[model samples]
Target: MADLKVNIGHLALKNPVMTASGTFGYGLEFADFIPLDGLGGFIVKGTTLKAREGNDYPRMAETPSGMLNCVGLQNKGVDYFCQHIYPQLKDINTNVIVNVSGSSPDDYAECASRIDALDNIPAIELNISCPNVKDGGMAFGVTCAGAESVVKAVRERYHKTLIVKLSPNVTNIADIARACEAQGADSVSLINTLMGMAIDIEKRRPVLSIGTGGLSGPAVKPVALRMVWQVARAVKIPVVGLGGIMNAHDAIEFLMAGATAIEIGTANFIDPSVTIKVRDGIDRWLDDHGCHSVREIIGCLD
Candidate 1:
């Protein structure tokens, strides 16, 4: 087969397919549906310093070829994750990337520092871009200064490979990507659910109880690809791209556009096996194209 191993800063992954945060719940939920080990790594749901009840019941809403989520980062806090969840996943072969979020820079750094103590956790994905939260999440990702502050703060506490997941709602993705790079981010992952809303027009109401929610799925592929290309070209640090990647073709587009690796987000909710399918599809396509390795296809576009 093809060599799919890739690097994110000093960390090494066996392949380029990873399950996105919020989509994959602690890597244990999908064990039966898809082999967790087949993935290079996967980010568990957003973990905070304190457990959050999340938003109201109507947190998830379906849209045309996309999804809007105001799940409000409903997670069991960092200690619950590291103490209870991490042990169960320690035996898994792939890397475990912790997705941590907080309302303040100190909260984010503390979350990272806590997860960093776990020996099995190879990296912590600083989620400065989760649009579901009220005050901090996406707010920290929209500006160059905000992004830099969170990254720099986490850099001091978390020593493992740090991947700053960026928000697509920003005015300039490359500027924020560069800011993260400058703040000691080992890698950057992009297009974390665009800010969107669904309306019930009949009652002049919003479909999501939280009003505006984060939009993700095939509807965002094009914008995500463009941002990934721009950010990849702008920074020397590796880029992990994700935005509505549902199939092999979409995965290839991301690799060609310059994503070192990719995360299958809403696609996972549609087809839990999507990530594995993409991995296999890329391999088959590589075989058909007379290419023996998957790395040869990464960032191939001019």
Candidate 2:
């Protein structure tokens, strides 16, 4: 079998396949059908300093080849997550990276502070992009200065691995990656969910009540691959690429393009065991190529 271990700053993952935020809930939800401990790490839903009611109905819309969501970082507060969620995941033999969302720098810091102090939670993925919210989120991730400011403040309080997830709705994604790196980000996750929308022609109204939402799935793969390659070259730390990754080959493409790791999002919705299949497929591909170490494929696009 091919070795699939990879590192994101100080955190070491068993493999390069991680689930995307919001899609996996708190990792506990998928523990039965999918083995959470078998994968690299599971990125839990977006947690805020306080509970969120989310937006109105029609928050999710299915597109031609993808889906749009305005989940609005809905979740129980950080304290609830630590007190209730963390304890359950402690028994699992894998890292549980919490995906955090907040409206202000102080909110981010406080949430980070609570999670960072926890023993079970190993990393924190700050969700910088989510178009379906009222307060902060993608608003701070699209701009370089905004990304830097948020990352910097969180870095001050969070001691564990800090992975700043970035939005694709930017002119220069490389600049945004660099901004997070400069602010002490241990790693970065790209292409959170592209801002998009779908209209109900029959009803003559927007499919989503929010009118617009973040898009994900196969349709965004090529665009996400390009962004991943660009940001991988720009940043010094590892980059976790996620946007339309469906199969093992798709994950391999991201790795070749420069992603140290890849996250399976909408694909999980279609097939619950997709991540393991991806892991198995990658192993087969590596063995066929006579490559024993998965690291050999990273940035091998030359």
Scored by lDDT, the top model is 1
TM-scores of all predicted structures = 0.96, 0.96
lDDT per residue as tens, model 2, 19-64: 9998888777776787888999999889999998888888998888
Residue 134, candidate 1: Cα error in Å is 11
lDDT of 2 at 92: 87
lDDT: worst 10-residue window of model 2: 129-138
Ten residues in a row with the worst lDDT in model 1?
129-138
